[model samples]
Target chain A: MRRWLAAHWRAFSATLARFAGAPLTSLLNVTVIGTALALPLGFYLVLSNLQGLARDYSPQPQVSIFLNIDAQEADVREITQRLKSQPGIAGFRFVPRDQALKSLQSRTGLGDVIAGLGQNPLPDAFVVDAGRKATALESLRAEFARWPKVAEVHVDSDWARRLDSLLALGRYAVLMLASALALALVAITFNTIRLQILTQRDEIEVAKLIGATDGYIQRPFLYLGSLIGCTGGAVAWLMVWGALWVFNGQLRPLAELYGIPLTLAHLNGSDSMATLLFAGGLGWFGAWLSVRRHLHHYNPS
Target chain B: MTQIVLSGVHKRYPGGHEALANISLAINAGELVFVTGHSGAGKSTLLKLIAAIERPSTGSVIVNGQNIGTLRARGIPFLRRHLGLVFQDHKLLFDRSVIDNVLLPLDINGFDRREGTRRARAALDKVGLLHKEKAQPITLSGGEQQRLCIARAIVHRPAILLADEPTGNLDADYATEIGVLFRDFNQVGVTVVLATHDMQLAARLNPRLIEVRAGRLAA
Candidate 1:
């Protein structure tokens, strides 16, 4: 165990030494890789932070169940009791036509025009709320439309469906971007490692002559590639975080106007760790491929 | 105690060049032997076969009790660990310091770094280049570079040391100095096989001399 630790430690330090040896080339590779990674990551941050704001800002779709204009007080009491007893329905409230008209008169400039009609022609209604998710509210709206004496059912979840479609599209776009950029990361690291192997061909020849195993020959390159990837991941994460920090300041007044507590979601610890590990894994894979292909040409005989 | 034995070994390249043919020989442990032949006479190929760098097309090459013909890819490094191989061009890593070049084998074998440094310095001292330990190999003269190669090869203390024309490019004085170094190593119980076409240099050392002509041992 000690020997294994020692060998890997040596490889790691040697990797750092090699990276330090050519500072400009290493910096160029890392910066390019970091920029590629940050693009998709920025898209993901926007999508997640938008979802966070939507959770608080958008009210769930409510089905306004209008009864016949002659619905009695006894019928209203029975319907309210039935709605409260239903399992899927969260809650409902009774809204008399007169109360609805009065609220609309105060909210709009058409109060005198509305008062010109001496008789209240509007019907009594119940606003029913199910769970906030689109699918549930949609199904509840459908169920409520079939209720006895329900003269009309007004479903306002069309905007919610549109918003959901947009979110889905954004999600797929982010996924596609991430996939393409991940490949770019792998290719960039592969090319860099290949160049490194070419430069170190003489050293590899000497090491092989001295009985270095294939594993030993490959160790430092693997570490170097992974270190580059991990550092790039950190750089990308910081780029996204910095962009959010700056944007969040601009978004504050808008969020305040909407009366919704809103802030952009930065990557948490596990997310950051996963990103680093994923990038490092891709870098290691690239190194492995290049090393396997190129090392065959070097024969110590 | 035979350190190397060859029985009916044959090597034919992909382009139909026969590099070796039906060669058979043996060297005992702790012996200083020389394989002397002109260019393309198969001396280097013979040493490479012993080092398991190339496989024989026929028969066997047994080095230190392991058959080169049957050794797998993973077994090559383990086989090489017991042998020190020196190239005609020295093959020194110019990017590293003299001491780091010597430390290559020890590092590959996972020796503790401090211990590896000590052993590397000792090997450098043996080659009379201890003062140049911190210098880059490219800065050294040809003879010093060759000596550095020798130090690296023997840093791991292998049982057999194989040199393919160790003095090929050296002047008479430097060649003689390297020959004496081999003799010194042989006296200390490391089997040495120094392959060279320089018959005069081989003659000066007066080790057991074998000649190769057109891929077979000449009688």
Candidate 2:
């Protein structure tokens, strides 16, 4: 295994030298792959940061389940307990009508007017911090609608769900974009490798005639494809970072508007590894498929 | 013992062009054999079959101790190490220097750079082109280029040498020089098979001659 690794390293060194020797061409190749990879990565960031904001600001999007005006205090407490056991309410707290009216008056600065005319017209309520995920909260909303003691469930999380769906739509958009670009990616690699094979066809014929096995001849191209894909992955990482950096300087107002901080979605260790494997796998498979099909045509022997 | 054997070997293209049909031969070790025929007479195909480049559809080809007809695609490189192949063009790796080109087989054979370089120089010296080890293919004369190719092929001291029109593009003198090199290598127990259409040139070498006529062995 050590020896094979060493051999592959030497082969790769040779490949790198060749790749470096043609810098302009390889740079073009890398850039093409990078662009293909960056689109999905960029969209992923938009969704990731928004998801982060949604996660941190859970209280901002909670549903306020107001009880019937005559509902018992004990009944409200029972609902709070039941909500705790429910999956969609991440957590909740009860507020009696008087406290609710008091807090509302303070926030709206209508306390004096409310103090003169009102006997706590506001109903007893439960404030629910909905689940981090939008889909999970839907069931909870449905349950509230069916309850007899519930006067209304005012879902403040509506905007969040809307925003998340927009983000989810954005994710689907990225998926569709990635799927389309993935086809382009494969074609890009396939064409690049095909041209390379055509240019190297003479060498291939000699290798074949000299008793070099098809695998032996095919090995170097496999390495080349993997390297191309790996390089593209690195380029993609840089592109994602570069884009975030450029936009980072301009996002302070956006963050303020959203009332939360967002760390721009960057590729994590897992994502980076996945992208590397993904891009490289794309390139390697492309080259392998290309060579397997064309090596026979150049077999002069 | 027959060092190379083929019987009833045939290659039919999918479109039904019979590239080689019923090729049969036995070549002894230590013999310099010339496969002479017109173009498309199956000379290249026969050589290819022996090297395991193309699979023979109808019969067996045995080289050294193994039946090449039974060899897998992955087995060809290891099999190639036993044979040195030369083409009409020197087919040097343009990206590498002459010494580096010669060292390629050694590299593949798992030899270190220093030892490979030493063997490369010695092989170049044997071909009378040692001083030009640092030169690239594009810089060398036609004769010198082919000689360098010969050096690269023999650097590993392969058991057999396969030359496909080695002198096809050369002048008479360069052609004869390459023939002499093959003769010398054969004398040293390297089994030599020279594939060419130059019958007059084949006579000068006085080697065992196999005529390939329309893909059939006509020796």
Candidate 3:
């Protein structure tokens, strides 16, 4: 076991020496992998931050049921009681026609135009707080619109629902981009290891002739590939962090304009670790494939 | 007491060129045997067969009682670990120092670094290349490079030593020196099988000679 460990250490150290030997080529390969990985990671960060913004700014989705202008007080009372008994409705507030007119005047600054018309154009409404998904909110709106005294129902959380759909789309796009880039990363490692094997073909032949097992001969290349992948992953992580830092700096003024503390979160611990392990695993697989293919063709005799 | 045996071994390359044909031979443990032939006479092929570097086409090559013709790919390395091989090309790693070249076999066998280094020095000392241990192989003369290959082959102290034209590129003096080294190794109880086209070197060593002509053993 100790000898095995020592062999592995030697292989690892030899890989490190190769990297040190060709600093420029190794750096270029790692940079390419890092840039490829960063694209998907950057998209994910933006999507996640947008989702967080939506959650923080709009805690509960709301649907507004506007009654007809001719709605009687009894109809309003019935609608209020119905809302109170609704399962998904968290809460509701009744706005009389006069209160609706007053709020419209205060918010829109169209009170002079409204008063010149000599009538309150606002209708009594019930603003309902619903803690449900976009589909559920739409269903509730449709249900409320079918009521006798309801003129129209509007989901005030429509923007949030659109944002959610957009986020879902972004997540899918990130996944696709991640998958494609992961394959590219593997291909890069495969080609890199192939070239290394070719350059060291003489050494491999000699080693095999001198009783080096196939495992012993392949160990150094495997180490080289995994180290490249792991270093590239770290570079990708740093690039993402740097991008987020820049994005957060730009978002500061925009966030202050809306008066919400908006900062894009960095990748969590598990996510960072997953990125590194996944990259390393891809590198190892690529090296394995290249080595298996090339080494099989070697006839030391 | 037979350390190497070939029973009607034949080797044919992909181009249908038969290198060895229906040849059978045996070399006992601690015996020094020379395989002498002209170019293309299958001398190197015989050494490769004994070293398990090449599988016989239709016969068995038994080295240390193991049938090399039937040895699995994974088992070949273990068989080769008990054998030292010297190639005509002087396949020394040019990227490493002389000492590192010698240390490779021991490293492959998983010997401890300290002990491997000690044995590597001893092997270099045997080849009279210890003074150039830290020098790169590319810097060595033709004779020195061949000596370095010998040192690398013997560092692990393998039971059997197979040399395919060990002095093929050396001058008369260097050739004689290499022949003496093989004789000294054989005296210490290591089976030494050497292949060469140099009849003078073979005669000077005065060991058992097996001649090959047209891929068949010469009667």
Worst 10 residues of 3 chain B by lDDT: B45-54
**C-alpha DockQ of every model:** 0.76, 0.46, 0.81
Order the candidates by TM-score, highest first — what do you get? 1, 3, 2
Q: Which structure is stronger by DockQ: 1 or 3?
A: 3
lDDT: which is higher, 2 or 3? 3
Give Cα distance to truth, residue B45, candidate 2, Å: 5.9
The estimated TM-scores of all candidates read 0.95, 0.83, 0.93
Which numbered prediction scores highest in DockQ against the true structure?
3
Query: Which interface RMSD values do the candidates have, in the order shown?
Result: 1.1, 2.7, 0.8
Write candidate 3's Cα lDDT for A1-301 as tens digits. Answer: 9999999998899899999899999999999999989889888878887888788887588888999999998998899888877887778898888988888889999989888978888899888988776668878988898988899998898787788888999899999999999999999999999999999999998888888899999999999989989998999999999988898999999989998788899989998999999888988988888999897667686
**Which 10-residue window of candidate 1 chain A scores lowest in summed lDDT?**
A49-58
lDDT of 1 by residue, B25-51 (tens): 999999999998889999999998988
What lDDT tens digits, residue by residue, belong to model 1 across residues A56-95?
A: 6567777788988888888788778878887776678899
- Best of the candidates, TM-score: 1
Ranking by lDDT: 3, 1, 2
Poorest stretch of ten by lDDT in candidate 3 chain A: A130-139
Error of 1 at B107 (Å): 0.2
Between candidates 1 and 2, name the one with more favorable DockQ: 1
